[model samples]
Structures are given as structure tokens and as C-alpha cells.
Target: MNLKFIKRNIFPLVKIISTVLITSAIGLESWNIYAFLTNRNVPSSLNPIFWIERFAMTSHFIESIIAAFYAHSGKKMPIQYATYTFFVGTIGLLELFDQEND
Candidate 1:
């Protein structure tokens, strides 16, 4: 197995999957908030997920800011990297690092 080939192909696939999964999680968290606001009954099992999702969202926001800073320092488009990092988290940051390396 060639390492470059795997990094070029598989890494992008991983990023796409990560973005989808994270976005879906945020969507679920949004629903949880809406449910709570509308006085809907939320299951006890989901209570834990609600808190976890909140933490994840906060972490991702911070990561996005870091990504923007990195991109700006590298003379790349900060907004693009920041938006991508917001959706894909660390995977997007990894990609930015890889681009810098290249």
C-alpha cells in the first residue's frame, strides 16, 4: 500500500464522513434544544447526549477559530478553513496542516 495514495484518497473520504457525522450531531442537538424550548418531553437517555453535544459544539467553535488563525498566518483564506473546521473539526485542521506541509 502506497502511503501517499492512501493519504490523498482515504484522508479526504475521512474528512467528508467526519463532516457529515458532526453536522448530523449538531442537528440532533438543535432538535434537543427546540424540544426543551417547546416543553416537549426529552428522554432521560438523551440528557447525556444533550450535554455532550453542547461540549462538542463549543470545542468545534474554538477549533474553527484556531483554524482561521492558522490559515491567516499561512496566507490562505481564513474564512474557508474556519467554515470547514466548524463542520469537520480536527479533520479539517489536519487537512490544513497537510496543505501547509505540501
Candidate 2:
């Protein structure tokens, strides 16, 4: 296969993957926060789950901001962004369903 073709395809794929991952992180974090708030006893900050939830929320927020900037500029974003968005979005959706099932 030609290197050029691979490069072209890879960039788009990357963007999608990133998106999905970021989105998933956000959803998972949100669920964690909700569960904590609803519970009589909140989880400690020192807990690993707390850290994971925080990171996931932060990642999602940052990715969303970047995506907004790219979209508002009316210019095509790099394939990396697209790939990221796709992954994040997918993860977010999955998280939502997972929470619902629980």
C-alpha cells in the first residue's frame, strides 16, 4: 500500500478515536458525580475513583472546547481532532447506557 494513502486515512481515524474517548470520559465522570451526590456518604477525594472521575470530566470539557473552536472557525479541523471526537462521543454514549443499565 502507498504511504500517502495510509497517511490520509490514518489522520481521519485518529480524529474519530480521540473524539469518542473524550466523550466517553465525560459521561463516566458525570455518572460518578451523580452517584456521589445522591448517596448519603460521598466518596473521599483520596480515592482512585474520585481521581478517575475528575480526569474524565476534565478531558471531556477540554475536548469539547477544542472542537467548538475548530467548528466556529469555519475551517476543517485536522484529522486528529475528528478521530478524537468520534472516540469520545462513542464512549460517552456507551457510558450513558451503562449507567442506565445499572
- RMSD (Å) of each candidate, 1 decimal: 2.1, 11.9
- Model 2: lowest-lDDT 10 consecutive positions: 89-98
| Clashes, model 1 | 0
lDDT of each: 0.83, 0.54
List where candidate 2 sits over 4 angstroms from the true fold. 1-6, 40-102
| lDDT tens digits, residue span 20-72, model 1 | 87787879987877988999987888878777877888888999999999996
Instruction: Give the candidate number with the greatest TM-score.
Output: 1
TM-scores, each model vs. reference:
0.79, 0.41
Clashes of each: 0, 27
Tell me how candidate 2 scores on lDDT: 0.54
lDDT, residue 8, model 2: 70
Please state the error at residue 95 of candidate 2 in Å.
Answer: 29
Lowest lDDT 10-residue stretch of candidate 1: 72-81
